[model samples]
Target: MSELSIFSYLPADDPEVLEQLQDRIELVRHKLKFVELVPTVACISSLSPLKLAGGLVPELIRLAGGTPVELEDLAAADPQYIIVALEGSPLNTAMSEVETLMALPGWESLDAVKNGRIYLADGEGHFSDSPAGIVETIEMIGEILNPKQFAFGYEGEGWIKFGV
Candidate 1:
């Protein structure tokens, strides 16, 4: 859809930029092909009311080699990777909120927390709905979920490992 939108509005004379975007998207897709059979991932975008991430966020997690835990069945799901990407929150602010989740019942026993797979990501900045942000967000997730396979240099800026 982002590609289609670009093609629809890009200047007719700037095929070069359009081609570049297409190439980038294709590369990301190809990388996604190598990611499969991953562990369950829990992506939370809020803490005050315990909101789960929705929209393309879950899709992106799947593409980045994660088995997204169904939001409706989260109580029964055992997540291996937990991502806290609070809407409108940067990395620092999101990091500060991890404690709230830790304090929740059964939080410390979760596989994600026990294995140190919790992460704080900059949702408002790099996890936006923009085409570029989506691509980068996928790469960042890939790096987080499958660190042995990917490293797009998004660490410390786009996301951070959280250990309680």
Candidate 2:
């Protein structure tokens, strides 16, 4: 199989740092040449289920340049890799989304095992002290799923883009 590339379209970050990271991330994109982009963003707290149904999810899929997996199919397929990007710290708010992801039957038992990974991108300045630690934790989760040495990656401030 080819190297799966998933892109997380997170929200606004610290304006000052975001400028630089945007350039770097674009460079990385060029280097990686990711084709299978699964674009995603952190869902804010203000959304209602009805509103999400209307256009929110669709927008994310559009941004990713791909289609969003149906909740039913997601559970049934049990993909080997998944990446989720957040606007803020995962501990603070992203966890809620994680809960939602976990609640899905497709993902409930599905886990990203070795070589499979998760990433944090386009986040605000609310991250913890050890960003590497966080990435490790995510990788560990992948290991749990696949029992292989999955590696987690993070792009600190470079992911945030202008006007986002």
Candidate 3:
């Protein structure tokens, strides 16, 4: 995967940049050691309940020391954190989906919903099918799962807190 390629590159082919990247990676690793072992899920329900599986999203969740919950297990898993990707921006299509999910039967009983951990992500640059997008998605997931350890300042870039 191209996102995984970041590990193979030398950080812009510059010694200084490479060193900085390595340092940042090490810091993230150190912080991941303290990440709470919580169940997490990422889904793109633009058409159907298509959950992220065997891709960068799951890898990112694992890197953040979170338990990646599969779609089949979501109903029974009661995930603590949920990353929802929509076909458009949060203000438009995404917000509608969030509201639809919120209206589902017993949806409010989920841990993610009850605790306000349902994050809304964009489908374009934020959750694209490219490697760079995956990297950004990982960074965002890291910030969401362990803000103290992985504060990459993803306020309005890849995702935002889900709100009514």
Once superposed on the true structure, which residue ranges of model 3 sit more than 4 Å away at CA?
Answer: 1-26, 45-54, 87-92
Candidate 2 vs candidate 3: the lDDT winner is 3
Per-residue lDDT of 152 in model 1: 81
lDDT of 1 at 14: 66
Model 3 per-residue lDDT tens digits across residues 90-164:
524665676566755457778888888887777656654454554556667778877766778875666778853
State the RMSD for candidate 3. 3.8
lDDT of each: 0.75, 0.33, 0.63
lDDT of 1 by residue, 45-156 (tens): 8888877787777777766777778663344676888888988788888977767877766786788878898889997887667666767777888889877677789999
Ranking of models by TM-score: 1, 3, 2
lDDT per residue (tens digit) for residues 53-162 in model 2 = 11233332332232333333443545444434343344334434545544544343554322234332322332212333223322332222223222223233322111
Instruction: Give residue 41's lDDT in candidate 2 (0 to 100).
Output: 19
Give candidate 2 misplaced runs (Cα > 4 Å): 1-26, 33-72, 86-91, 108-164
